[model samples]
Structure formats: C-alpha cells, structure tokens
Target: MRPFTYEVPSSIQEATSRGGADAAFIAGGTTIVDLMKLEVMNPSRLVDVNPLPMLGIQMREDGLRIGALEKMSDVAEHPEVVANYPVISEALLQSASAQIRNMASIGGNLLQRTRCGYFRDVFTPCNKREPGTGCSAIDGENRMHAILGTSSSCIATHPSDLAVALVALDASIYIQNGAEERVMNLDDFYLVPGETPDHENQLRPGELITAVRVPRLLWARRSTYLKIRDRESYEFALTSAALALDLNGDTIRDVRIAVGGVGTKPWNLPEVRQALAGKPLKPETFAAAAKLAVNGANPLRHNGFKVDLVQRTIVRALMNLGGLA
Candidate 1:
C-alpha cells in the first residue's frame, strides 16, 4: 500500500471537513486496501470513521435499522435479521469469506468497487477506474461483466450482494455531510454507469453514509437470495436474484425483485413484479415473469449468456422462496 497519513475523526463534522477528492473515508479497509495494493487508488489521507457512532443494528417498529459501520458478519448472523429478512442474511453469508465478512462493514460492502479484471489492473484501460481512457473489457474477456444498464463507457457488473437484497426490500440510505443529513432510496443511491463510469454512486464528496433503513414488509419474511456462480462458495455471483413474494392462497399478492452480477447497478425488475402480481404461483407464471427481466439487456460477445442466466436465476429464486419447485 502507498504511504498515507491516517486520522481517526471523533465526529462526523470533523471527518467531512477532511473528506474530498484527495481523502478517503476508511471503515473496514477491505475495499480501499485491496485497490491501494493494486495501485488502482491512491488517496493521500485516510479519514477513519470507525469511531463516529455508526455502529448499531436495531429492530424498530418501522423496520430494521442497520448502522453503516456494522460488521457484515454481525448483521448476517443477527437473530432479528435472520428471522425477519432472510434475503439480507443470506446475501451477507454468501458474500466474500468468513474472514472478510468479519472485517467488512455494511457501508463498505455497499460501496465496494467492481471486481472486473481490467478495472483492478492499473495498467489496463478501464473506464470505471479512469474515465475516457477506454473500457478494455468491452472487447476483451468480459464473461463476468454486465449486460443490463451497461453503457459504451463501461460494462462492469456491480459486485455487492447486500445491495441487491436491500434494493429489493426498498431500503433507504441515510447520509451525512457534516451536520446536514439526508435519506435516499437504496435503488437511487447507485447511479447507472452512463457517460461517467467512474461515478459509480450518488454519494457526494465529503458525504458519509450513516445507516440503512429497510422498511417492514410482509413479503420480506418470505424472501430469498439465490446466487449462481462458477463455484459453490467463496465466489462472486455470475447471476443472482433477491426475491420476495406475498402470496394470497396460491396467487401472488405482491412481489419485489432485484438482481446482481448482471447489471451496472442492482437491477430491479418492476415489470416482472407487475406481470406476476395477481397470477397464481406456478412454474409457468415464474417463467413468464422471468422472461421480462431481459427486456433491455444489451449483451456483449462473451456475456450473452447473462441475458438467459439472469432470467433463470430469477425464476429459480422465486421458486425457492415460494416453495413451488
């Protein structure tokens, strides 16, 4: 890692005062350290936010409130989280490894960078790493890259499993810039990789995420997170789905769907949810809804498989959650 000065700010105001283009907020140092070692990121100063009162996991009457600094392992294994939000628990347990989960914070996981090979290698031209430089993955080995919400500037798949589950639950992120605080839906917090691929999220300079709130939903209790990858464990998802269903008898009353590892962001499928809303929970209905997932998919040479894989993953997730399979 590059030589850098570190500061542990006692307050959010002090941290935001030092945060800018040259400084980075470090919590778990999981993502930042990896990029620093690869020489992909070089921040002059590191502002530690671990002591800034951002560590708590509470269940309120409204919903589940997860502090940004809460460790991934703690959240995943929390009794309340596992009982109420199986999708969230499963997503966390399925991410990275036990050692990483023990160290990574919830906020850090949500803001983790893409795992694209080109993006991690400083020598390669990755638009996400250096905008306008070029996206080598577009024409290179891009089997793990994105197909949905992809722009010509970048096709890197979003790497967060927690983000996918939270977006499906319609979670809201609380952010603080100095003393000013704001909340935004998790779905809107991540910007699509448009012309500016380097701009991955909606977090402004000097802003720090405080907590993520997931509203209570009847479907949330029946949710499931299903991932398909090259290996069984300790692997990133090639195509994954976070599915929640509220069923009335054999019919679907409501549903929420979000996908990861196949899009520039956590891809939500409202159309599919709408298509299956009042339908009977059956294999045919699941397949029909799944087909709508790839409505605007722009698959590349080596990643055309994602278009089909995304649909299959969604169907399987729904089946797994609904006990239809």
Candidate 2:
C-alpha cells in the first residue's frame, strides 16, 4: 500500500476544505481502504469525516433522513426504519456481514465501488479505474457484468442493495461543500459508463454527502427486497429487485421498482411500473410487468442469463410483496 496522510476533521467546513483531487473524504473506510490496499486507489490524503458530528438517524414528517456517518447496522435496526421502511432495512441487513454492516456507513455504502474483478486487480485493464485503458469484463469473464445500461466501453454493475431500495423509494441525497448545500434525486445520483467510465457518480470534488432523505410512500410498508446470488449469504447478487406497490383492493394504485446486480446503476424500471399501474395484482400481470423490466437489455457473452434472471426476480419480488409468491 502507498503511504498517505490522514486527517480527521472536526467540522464539515474543515473536511470539505481539506478534500481535493488527491484527497478523499473517508467515512467507515470499508470500500476506500480495500482499494487503497490493492493499489487501485492511491489517494495522497485521507480526510476522515466520522468526527464531524453528522452521524444519526432522524424520522421527519416528510420521511426519514439518515446521516452520512450512521452505521448500516444502526439504520437496519432502527424501529421506524424496520417497520415503516422494511425494504430499506432488509436491503441493509442482507448486504455484507454483521461485522461489515456494523462498520459501514450509509454514505460510504452509497459510494461503494463496483465489484468488477478487473477493476479490483490493479494489473488488469479496467476503464472504470483508468479511462481509455479498455474494459476486460467486456469479453472476458463477464458472468457478473451488467445487462442493462451497458455500453461498448464498460459493463460494470453497481454493487449496492441499499442504493437500489433507496432509488425505488424515491430517495434524495444531500451534499454540502463548505456552506453551500445541494440536493438531488437518487435516480440521478449515478451515471452510465459511456465513453468516460472513470466518472461514476454525480458528486463533485470536495462535496461531502451529509444525509440521504427517503420520501414517505404508501407502499413503503408493503415493499420487499429480493436478492438472488450464487450463495445464500455474504455474497454479491446475481439479480436483485426492490419493489413497492400500492394496491387498492386487488388493483395496483401505484408502483415503484428498481433493479440491482443486472444494471450499470440502480435501475428504475419505469416501463414495468407503468405496466403494473392500474392493473390487478396477478401472476399474469406480474409476468407481463416482468417482461417489461428487461426491455432493451443488452447482455454480454457470459451474462446472458441475467436478462432472464432479472425478469424472474422482478416477478418473484412483486409476487412476494403482494403475498402471492
């Protein structure tokens, strides 16, 4: 590992001021530390923001506002979160392990890096790590690569179950740079890997994420997060679905759906949501809606199964949430 200077800022102003091109704001250090050890990320300075007094979980009238430094375990165990937003709590609980969940923060979870093998291996060519270097996953060992929002330049999938649930729930992110603050919808948080795969998120340099705000929805109480991986626990997803539906009697009043492990980013399936809206919650309807989920999917050589797996996962998720599965 490369030698680096570490700074623990007591204030957000100091943290923002200290962050630059060669510096990164560290919270939890679950993802950043691994990359640093692998020589994939060589930041000259690590700005620790855990001491900035920004760690807490608050329930507001609008919805829930989770602090950037709040641990995943805390958020998962929060009574309000577990009861009101079971999808969010379940997603967090299903990720990593107990030790990692206890150590990883919500902000750091949102900023977790892709699980692409080539990117993790510093010796291999990975466009996400270094632009114009090419993507090895494109034609080499791409079983876990993305099927949706994939481009010729890259095929890496975003590896965050929490982010997927947040996207389905219409979450917002709060970013602060010095005294200036900005908020953006979680749907716009991630960018597709096009010509420039190195740029992953919409966050600007020195901008620190203060909190994540999830809007209250009627279906939040009846939502579910279904992840299917190679193993039962402590593994990355093969295909996952985060679904929330508002059912009026037997008909769907509203629907929000986001998919993970099969897309370049947390994918919101508006087409599927639209198809299910105003329709009866039935197996056939779910099958039809699931079909829409994989529309325009361009699967890679080794990841063709994801196209079908994602559809089935979506169907199962909808059925489970509707008490039909």
Candidate 3:
C-alpha cells in the first residue's frame, strides 16, 4: 500500500474538500480499502465520511428514501424495505457475505467496481484501469466479462446485485456538492463504457451521494430477485434478474425488469417489459418476452453462455414471482 493522508470529516462539506482531487471518500471502506491493498486503486488521501450523519430510512408519501451510508444488512432488514420493496431486500441479502453486507454501505455498493481479473490485476493492461492501455479481458480469459452494453474498450460486468433491483424500481439518486443538492434517475447515473471506459458515473469531484429514493410502486410488492452463480454463497452472479410485476387478474398490467452479471451496467429490459405488459401472465408469455432481453447482446469468446443464461434467469425470476415456477 502507498503512504497516504487520512482525514476524518464530521460534515459533508468538510469531507468533500478534505483532500486533493485524488482523494477518495471512505464510508465502510469495504471496496476502496481492498482495492488500495491490491494496488488496483491508490488515492493520495482517504477521507472518512462515516460521521457525516447520512443515516436513517424514511417512508415518504412519494417513495422509500434510504440513506447513502446505511449498511446493506440494515437496509435489507428494515421492515419498510422488506415489506414494500421485497426485491431490494432480497438482492441485498444475496449480495456478498453476511459480514460484508453488515459493513458495506449502500452508496459504496452502488459504486462497486468491476471484478474482472484483468481489471483488478495491476500488472495486466486494462482499459478500465488505465485508459489507452487495451482491455485484456476482451481477448484473454473472459468467462465473467459482460455481454450487453459492451464496447471494444471494455467488456467488464457490473458486480452490484442491489443495483440490479434498484434499476427495476426506476430509483432516483440524491446527490450533493456541498450544499447544492440535485436528484437524477438512477438509470442515468451510470454511463456506458463508450470510448472512455474509465469514467463510470456522473459524480463530479467532491460530489457526494446523499440518499436514494424508490418511488411508490405498489405492484413491486410482487417482485423478486433471482441470481445464478457458479456456486452460490460469497460469489458474484453469473446471471441475475430483478423483476417487478403488476398483474391485473390473469393479465399483466405493467412490468419492470433489469438483469445483472451480463451487462456493462445494470441492464434494463424495456423491450421485454413492453412485450409482457397487458399480456396474460403465462409460462409461454414470460418465456417469449424473456427472449427479448438478449436483443442486441454481443457476447465475447468465453462469456457467450451469458446470452442464454440471462434469458433463463429472467424467465425463472418472472415465473417464481408470478407463482408459475
């Protein structure tokens, strides 16, 4: 590890301006600390923001608002989240291990970096790690690489299961630049690995994420998150699906779907959602619409299995949620 300055900021304003541009904000230090040790990410300074009072979960009339610093375990176990946003709770519980879930902050998890071997190994050349350097995962070992929203510069899969669920809810993020506050749809927060694969989000320097809001979607109570991995525990998903359905009698009223472990970001299937809406909630209905989830997927050499895996995962999630499985 490199020698660095450490500062504890009691206020969000202090935290944001505590260190240089290379300074990193630390809440639980679950992701930042590990990457620093591996030399995958090394900041000149570490600014601790745990004491900034970014806490509490609120059930507002508009939505369920979650503090950015809230632990994954706490959010998952919160009765409001569990009762109203079942898929969000399920996704959090299925993420990492119990110990990690207890310590990892919700904000940190949303910003979790790719787990691609080439991206993590500093010795290897990766576009995500260092721009202009070619992505090794593209031609090298890429079984865990992305299939959807991939570019020539990168094919790394997003590793956040919670993000997948949030995507399905069409959540919004509340951000702060000192006192100035703004909110944006969570879907727009993440950027694709277009020409510049290094830039992942829209967070400007010193901007801090304050909270996340999930709008009041009554039908999300009938939602579920399904993940398929090589093993199960303490593993990243090979294919994960998050679905929220609104069924009117035997017909689908509205639906929201997002898939993880197969995309550069949490992949939302608007086409699939559109196809399933108003259609009868049947086995064949789900199986057919699920196929649209892979409309423009560009699978690489080793990760071609994801093309089929994601579809099956989506079908299973929808089936289980609709009690057809």
Candidate 4:
C-alpha cells in the first residue's frame, strides 16, 4: 500500500475542506483496504469519517433515513427495516458474512468496487480503473460479465446486493459538501460504464454521502430478495431479483423489480412492471413478464446462459412473490 496522510474531521465542513481529488473517506475500510492492497486504488490521503456524528438510523414521516456511517449489520437488524422492509434485510443478510456486515458501512457498501477479476489485477487492462486502456474481460474470461447496460468500453457488473434492493425500493441518496446539500435518486446515482468507465458515481470531488432515504411502501412489507449463486452462502449472485408486489385480490396493483449480478447496474425492469400492472398474478402472466425482463440482453460468449438464467430467475421471483409456485 502507498504511504498516505490520515485525517479525522469533527465536522462535515472540516472534512470537505480536507478532502480532495487524491483523498477518500474511509468508513469501514473493508473494500478500500482490499483495493489498496491490490494496487487498484491509490489515494494520497485517507479521511476517517467515522468520527463524524452522522451515524444513526431514523424513521421519518417521509421514509427511513439511514445514515451513511451506519453499519450494515445495524441497518439489517433494525426492527423497522426488518419488519417493514424484508428485501433490504434479506439482501444485507445474504451479502458477504457476519464479520464483514459488522464492519462495512452503508456508505461504503454503496461505493464498493466491482468484483471483476480483470479490474482487480493492476497489470490487466480495465477500463473502469484506467480510461481507454481497454477491457480485458471483453476477449478474456467473461462468464460473470454484464448482459444489460453494457458498453463496449466496459462489461463489469455492479456487485452490491444492498444497492439493488435500495434501487427496487426507489431510494434516494443525500449528499453534502461543506453545507451544500443535494439529493439524488438512487437510479441516477450510478452511471453507465460508457466511454468513461473510471467514473462510477455521480458524486463530485469533496462530496460525501450523508444518508439514504427509502420511502415507505405498502408493498415493501411483502418484498423479498431472491439470490441464486453457484454456492449457497457467502457468494455473489449469478442472478438475483429484489421484488415487491402490491396485490389487489390476485391482480397486481403495483410492482417494483430490480435485478443484480447480470447487469452493469441494478437493472430495473420497467417494461416487466408495465406488463404486469393490473394483470392477474398467474403462472402464465409471470412467464410472459419474465420473458420481457431480458428483452435486450447482450450476452457475451461464456455468459449466454445468463440470459436464460435471468429470465428463469425473474419468473421464479415473481412466483415466489405471488405465492403461486
């Protein structure tokens, strides 16, 4: 790891003043330390944000506002979260392990790096790490590459179950930079890996995530996160679905769907939601909606099976949500 200066600011303004292009906020240091050890990330300074007072989960009239410094385990185990938002709890429980969940912060989870093998190896060309350097996964092993929202410049998948669940819940992020505060929809927070794959988020220099707000939903209580991986536990998803359904006498009143593990971002299926709106929750209806989920999938050579697998996963998720399986 490179030698770097460390700073702990007492206030957000002080932190922003200390942060720069070469500085990064250290929350849990799980993901950051790993990347630093791999030489994928080299920062000249580390700003410890844990000392700040922005570290609480509160239930507001509008929704649940989770502080960026809140630990993953605390958020997952919060009574309001587990009782009202099962998808969020399940997504957190299924990610990493108990130890990691204990140490990883909600903000760090949102900013975690991709699990792409090529991106981890500094010697390999990764467009996400080094712009215009070429993507090694394009011609190399790409079984876990993205099928949706993939550009020629990059095919790396976003590897955050919590982010996928949050997207499905239509969450928003609150950002602060020296008293200038702004809110952004979670869907728009992450950028597509087009020409500038190195730029993953919409956050600017010296900006810090303050909190994430998830609006209250009637269907949120009935939601679930279904993850399918090669192994059962402590593994990334091959294809996963975070779904919430509002049912009115077996008819789908409203549906929220976000897919993970097969897309460059948390793939929200608006078309599928449109197809299922006001439709009866039946097997055939789910099958048809599932078919529409992967409508424009651009699978790579080794990941063509993901197209079919994702469709099946969506169908199964729908079935599970409707209790029709």
Candidate 5:
C-alpha cells in the first residue's frame, strides 16, 4: 500500500469532518485495505471510525437498528438478528470466512466493491475503476458478471450478501454528513452501472453511514437466504436469493424478494413478489414467479446458465423458507 496518513476519529462529527474528496472512512478495513494493497485505490488519508459512537446493535420503536460499525459476526449471531431476521443472519454467516466476518463491519459490507477480476486488476480496462476507459468483462471472462442492470459500459455485479437480505426486507440507511443527517431506502442507495459505472451509490460527500433500520415485518421471521456457488465455503455466489414470506394457511399473503450475483446492484424483484401474492405456496406458484425473476435479463455467452440458475435459486429459497420443498 502507498504511504498515507491515518487518523482515529473519536466521534461521528470528527470522522465526517476529516473524510472528504480524497479521504476514506475505514471501519474494519477489510475492503479498503485490499484495494489499497492492489493499488486500485489510493487515498491520501484514512479516517478511522472504529472509535466513534456508531457501534451497537439495538432495538427501538422503529425496528432493529444495527450500528454501522458492528462486526458482521457479532450482528449475525446477535439474539435479535438471528431470532427475528434469519435471512440477515444467514447472509452474514454465508459471507466470507469466520475471521473476515469477525473483522468486517456492516457499513463496510454495504459499500464493498464488485469482485470482477478485470475491475480489480490495474492492467485491465474497467469502467468502474476508470470511467470511459472500457469494460474488459464485456467480451472477456464474464461468467460471474451481471445479467441484469448491465449497461454497455460495465457488467460487474455488486458483491454484497448482506445487501441482498437488507434490500429484500426494505431496510433504510441512516447517514450523517457534518451535523445534518438523512435517511434513504437501502434499495435506492445502490445505482445501476449505466454510462457512469464509477458513481456507484447515493452516498453524499463527507457522509457517514450511521445505522441500517430494518422495519419489523410479520413475515420476516419466516425469511431465508440461499446462495449458489461453485464450492461450499468462502466463494462468491453465482446466483443467490433472499426471500421472506407471510402465508395465510397454504396461500402467500405477502412476500419480498431480492437477488444477488445476477445484477449490477442488489436486485429487487417486485414483479415476482406481486405474482405470488395470495397464490398457493405450491411448485407451480414458485415456478411462475421464478420465471419473472429473469424478466429483463440479458445474459452473455458463458453466463446464460445464470438466467435459469437464478430462477431456480429463487424458487428453491422460497420453497425452503415456506417449508414446501
């Protein structure tokens, strides 16, 4: 890593004050450190937010409020998160290895970059790394790239397991910049890689993510996360699904669905959710909605299997959560 100055901010205000254009906020340093070592990212300053006040898991009248700095392992194993939002807990557990989760922070996880090989290598042309340069994954090895939310500029998929679960649950991000604060839906925070693939999210300059609020949904307790990968552990997903269902008898009352490893961002499938509303929790119902999961998909040569794989994964996740599989 290149030479850089590091400062530990004792408060959120201090953290944001120091984090500006060429400065980055580091919580666990899991993502930022890797990029730095690769020389893909070189910030002049690093503002450490670990000592800040944003570091707790709490329950409030609104919903489950998870502090931004809370470790992934801790949040996954927390009584409230594990018992109430199994999807969230499962996503975190199924993420990186035990050691990485112990060190990675929730906010950092949400802001994590794509895992596209071309994007990480400085030698390759990646629109995400250098805008207008070009995207190597477009015509190269793109089996793990995105099918949905892809533009001619880039097709790298957002690699956040936690983001899929949170987006499915309609979570909101609490952000603070200086003394002002704002809240935005977790789904709205991520941007599709259109012409400007470098502009990834809706985070404002000098803003710090404080916490994520997951509103308590009656059906969330019956939620689950399913990840399909080449191997069992420490592998990024090829196609993953996060599903929550509220069933009335054998019929579905309400459902939420978000997919990962298939989109430029954590993808929400509202059409699929709408299709399953009031429908019987049967194989036919799942198969029909699963088809809609790939409604706008544009698959590459080698990644065409993902079109069908994502659909099957969605059906399997829903069935497993609803106890119909």
Candidate 6:
C-alpha cells in the first residue's frame, strides 16, 4: 500500500473538516485497503471514522434504523433483522466471506467498487478506473459485466448485494456534510455511468453517510435474497434477486424486486410490480412478469446470457418466496 497519513477524528465535525478529494474515510478498511494495495486508489490521507457516533441497529415502529458503521455480520445476525427482514439478513450472509462480513461495515458495503477485472488491474483501460480511457470490458471478456443501465462509457456491474436488497425494500440513506444533513432514496444514491464513469455515487466531498432506514413493510417479512454465481462461497453474483411479496389469498397485493450483477446499479422492476399487482400469483404470472425485466436491456457480445439468466433468476426467486415451485 502507498504511504499515507492516518487520522482518527473523535467527532463527525472534525472528520468532515478533514475530508477532501485527497483524503479518504476508512471504517472497516475492507474496500479501501484492497484498492490501495493495487494502487488503483491513492489517497494522501486516511481519515478514520470508526470513532464517530455512527453505530446502532434499532428497530422502530416507523422503520429499521441501521447505523452506517454497524458491522455486516452484526446486522445480519441480529434477532430483529433475521426475524423481520430476511432479505437483509440473507443478503449479508451471502456476501463476501464469513471473515470479511465480520469486518465490513454496512455503509462501506454499499460504497464498494465494481469487481470488474479491468477496474482492479490498473494496467487495463477501464472507464470506471480512469475516465475517458475507454472501457476494456466492452469488447473484451465481459461475461460478468452489465447489460442493464449500461452506457457506452462503462459496462461494469454494480457489486453490492446489500444495495440490491435495500433498494427492493425502498430504503433511504441519511448523509451528513459538516452541519447539514439530508436523506435520499437508496436507489437514487447510485448514479449511472452516462458520461462520467468515475462518478459512481452522489456523495459529495466532506460528506459521510450516517445511517440507512428501511420503511416498515410488514410484507417484507416474506422476502428472500437468492444469489447465483459460478462457485458459491466468497463468489460474486452473476445474477441475484431480492424478492418480497404481499399476497391476498391467491392474488398478489404488492411486490418489490431489485436485481444485482446485471446492471450498472441495483435494478428495480416497477413494471413487474405493475404486472403482478391485483393479479394471480402463479407460475405463468411470474414467468410473464419476470420477462419484463429486460425491457431496456442492451446486452453485449459476451454478457448477453445475463439477459435470460436474470429473468430466470427473478422468476425462481419469486417462486421460491411464494412457495409456488
């Protein structure tokens, strides 16, 4: 890793004061360290935010409030989270490895960089790694890249399993920039590559994520996070589905779904919701609605399999959650 100055700020104000383009906030050092060793990221200073008061996992009548610094394993293994939000728990348990999960923070997981081979290997021309250098994955070995929400500038699939589940739950994030604080929908926090591939999120300089809140959706209790990958353990998802359903007898009352490993961001399917709402919950309904997931997908030469794989994964997740298989 490159030599850098480290500072552990005692307060949020002090940390925000220390933040800038040349400085980075480190909590678990899971993502930051990996990129640093590869020299893909070279921050002059590392501001430790572990001491700041961004810690808690509270269940409220309004929602489930999870502090940004909360460890992934703690949140995943919490009694309330496992009982009330199976999707969140499963998403965490299925991510990384048991050891990494024990060290990674909730906020850091959401901020993880893409696992695209080119982005990690500084030798390659990855738009996400170095803007305007051209995306090597576009015409190279891109079987693991994205098909949805992809731009000519970048085709890297988002690598956060937690983000996909949270997006399905309609969660929001609380952010602080010095004294000002604001909340934004989790889905909106991730920006598409459009033209600036390097600009992945909406977090401005000196801003820190405080917490994430998931609105109380009792139906979310009947949710599942299903990830499909090459091997399984410690592997990234090729296509994963986070599905929750609200059923009235045999009919669907409501549904929420967001897919990962196939898009530039956590891809939510509102059209699928529209198709299933007030309709019967059956294999045919699921199959038809799942097909709508690729409405605007632009599959490339190698990743075209994702187009069909994602739909099948969605249908299987819905079936597994609904017990219709």
lDDT of 6 by residue, 1-325 (tens): 8899999888998898899999999999999999999999999999999999999999999989999999999999999899889999999999999899988999899999999999999999988888889989888999999999999999999999999999999999999988888999999999999999899999998789989999999999999999999986789999999989999999999999999999999998889889989988788998899899999999988989989999999989988888887
lDDT by candidate, in order shown: 0.92, 0.91, 0.91, 0.91, 0.93, 0.93
lDDT of 4 by residue, 87-139 (tens): 99999999999999999999999999999999999999889998888999988
lDDT of 2 by residue, 1-325 (tens): 8999989887898888898889988888889999999999999999999888787788888999999999999999999898889899989989999999989999999999999999999899988898888989988999998999989889999999999999999899999998888999988989998898888888888889999999977568888899999999999999999988898999999888999999899999889888999999899999988998888899878999998899899999888888887
Error of 4 at 25 (Å): 0.9
Tens-digit lDDT track of model 3 for 150-195: 9999999999999999988999998888778899888899989998
Collision count for each candidate, in order: 0, 0, 0, 0, 0, 0
Clashing residue pairs in candidate 1 are: none
The TM-scores of all predictions, comma-separated, are 0.99, 0.99, 0.98, 0.98, 0.99, 0.99
Q: Ten consecutive residues with minimal summed lDDT in candidate 4? A: 51-60
| Candidate 5 residue lDDT tens string, 144-170 | 999999999999999999999999999
Write model 1 residue lDDT over 13-64, tens digit each, in one string: 8898889998899999999998999989999999999998888899999999
Name model 6 segments beyond 4 Å from true. Answer: none
Model 3 Cα shift for residue 153 (angstroms)? 0.2
- Itemize residue pairs with steric clashes in candidate 4: none
What would the TM-score be for candidate 1 when compared with the true structure?
A: 0.99
Error of 5 at 18 (Å): 0.8
Error of 5 at 47 (Å): 0.7
